[model samples]
Target: MSDDVTAAADAVRHGEVVVYPTETVYGMGADATNPDAVERVFDTKGRDRDKPLSAGFPSVDAALEYVVTTDLEVAFMRRFLPGPVTVVVERRDALPDVLVAGRDRVGVRVPDHDLACDFFERADTPVTATSANRSGTGSITNPSQLSDDVREAVAVVLDGGTTPGTESTVVDPGRGIIHRRGAMADDIETWLAEHADSEPDA
Candidate 1:
């Protein structure tokens, strides 16, 4: 691993936040299971406490450790994960309530970026997967665009050049709902419609 990636991972394990690149955009990361670390993310971004943050893992299999997934959800993950998509599913007790905002469900992200996955794997835990920007502000595509507040709040910044800058599509496959339409919306919608019959009754 590169020195920057290793530092970022170490910061996360030490309950500090870091900024890292993702396939969609730059993301603010902290140990998702740590309530204090998660609170720091919300505070740093001035984000509403009720607004839940997604947890990022190195892979779908790693994410499965923190979320409860049905067969349909598993199929959906297999089809679109390691891409720009946030799959919402039930959270395991291992996740802090702060991360999910006291909600039963949480968003799971497996970014299709080598740096991100490497950081997650080295961190050895799920990390907060929210954009690396203050709430209500634009998402960041490059480390150069990161605000002073965000930069100062984070312990490390892993610059992986520029990112695609699009937000990931957020969907609840079990409920067959698309909470937010973003990258690959059309393809995701098509997949959902074609697999609607397989979704568990809501």
Candidate 2:
């Protein structure tokens, strides 16, 4: 695990992509600040550039600026972050275009795992994170489920056993933010009910 983490960090530093696990599912990551590396992730996944992706933070505190503003949302974030939830927020000016599809918004999450954050820190910035599988395919739960291309594309593999076998809850609090039904769990809904209106990003 240590060797793989080391190699993953090295690959990210050299503008290579790697897959890392979170409490939810495996996410392919690269140096977010490096446009070329980030573009590769979009290409590899056949993702729509117009569809912005979230950036995983090392901790909730690291994500404060992006989401926390009002006390209700702030408190909500303090409670739910570092867990399996992605909060929508108004994008900051410096955020890259590829991050949120050049939209006025972005998604922020601080995974409840050390290895996930370690990858972010190693990349020297937040990395674009999405399910490790091809777009529209079921997410890979275990390293064994990963394809040969995924394996060969990465410079290192960190087998954290298996991921949570599910995806994170994505919530949009502000106006014009609509999330599909049944995509998130009940707990996430509870949190959203109380803080959605207070979210500054909306």
Candidate 3:
């Protein structure tokens, strides 16, 4: 890996936060198991430490390894991944309370972007994910366009050209709540609908 990628991955390994690209938007990330590292994210974003954040993995199985993944979680992972969709599933003891915001479940995703996928390869563990921007604001889709404050604040930035400029569609598969109107095309949605039916309930 180049020095920049190595440094970014090292930051994560050391429990520091790093800003990186995902197909949907720029995301700030930390080692999913490190509560203190996770705390730094909230402090940096001035985020409500109480608000739960989701995690992104390279693949469904990768995510399942970190948490107390259920059949529904695994089913949903099989159903919608390498696409812009998030799933909420039961949390495991390994996750910190702050990451889940005192909630019983945690969100998980597998972004369709290559650079983001590399995180799973680099960290060899799950990484909590949230948009780089503050709460209630539009997600930053283009890393190149990020303000200096946002850019400089992060330990490293991986340029992934202009992203699709849309955030991932979220779904609470655990509760059967279709939380987000995902950004994929109709064909993909139709595929999701079809696959969802075939999968057994959690």
Q: Which candidate should be chosen as best, given TM-score against the real structure?
A: 1
Q: What are the Cα lDDT values of the candidates? A: 0.94, 0.73, 0.76
In candidate 2, clashing pairs total 1
Question: Per lDDT, what order, best first?
Answer: 1, 3, 2
Question: For residues 1-202, could you state the per-residue lDDT of candidate 3 as single tens digits?
Answer: 3666677888888888888888788888888788898887887677897788888788877877766765655766786787788777887878888898988888888888777888657876678788887666667877766666666666777777677767777776655566667675454455556667655566
Give per-residue lDDT, candidate 3, residue 124. 67
Task: Give one clash count per candidate, in the order shown.
Answer: 0, 1, 0
Off by over 4 Å in 1: none
TM-score of 2: 0.86
Per-residue CA lDDT of candidate 1, range 1-202, in tens? Answer: 3998889999999999999999999999999999999999999999999999999999999999888989999999999999999999999999999998999999999999999999999999999999999999999999999999999999999989999888999999999999999999999999999999976644
Please give the range of 10 consecutive residues that has the lowest summed lDDT in model 3.
184-193
Distance from true location, Cα of 19 in model 3, Å:
1.1
TM-scores of the candidates are 0.98, 0.86, 0.86
Q: For residues 70-185, what per-residue lDDT tens digits would candidate 2 score against the true structure? A: 56555656777778877777766556777677777677878888888877766666777777887778898788888787777776667787876767777665442435332356
Model 3, TM vs. native: 0.86
Quote the positional error of residue 147 for candidate 1 in Å. Answer: 0.9
Flag the better candidate by TM-score, 1 or 3.
1
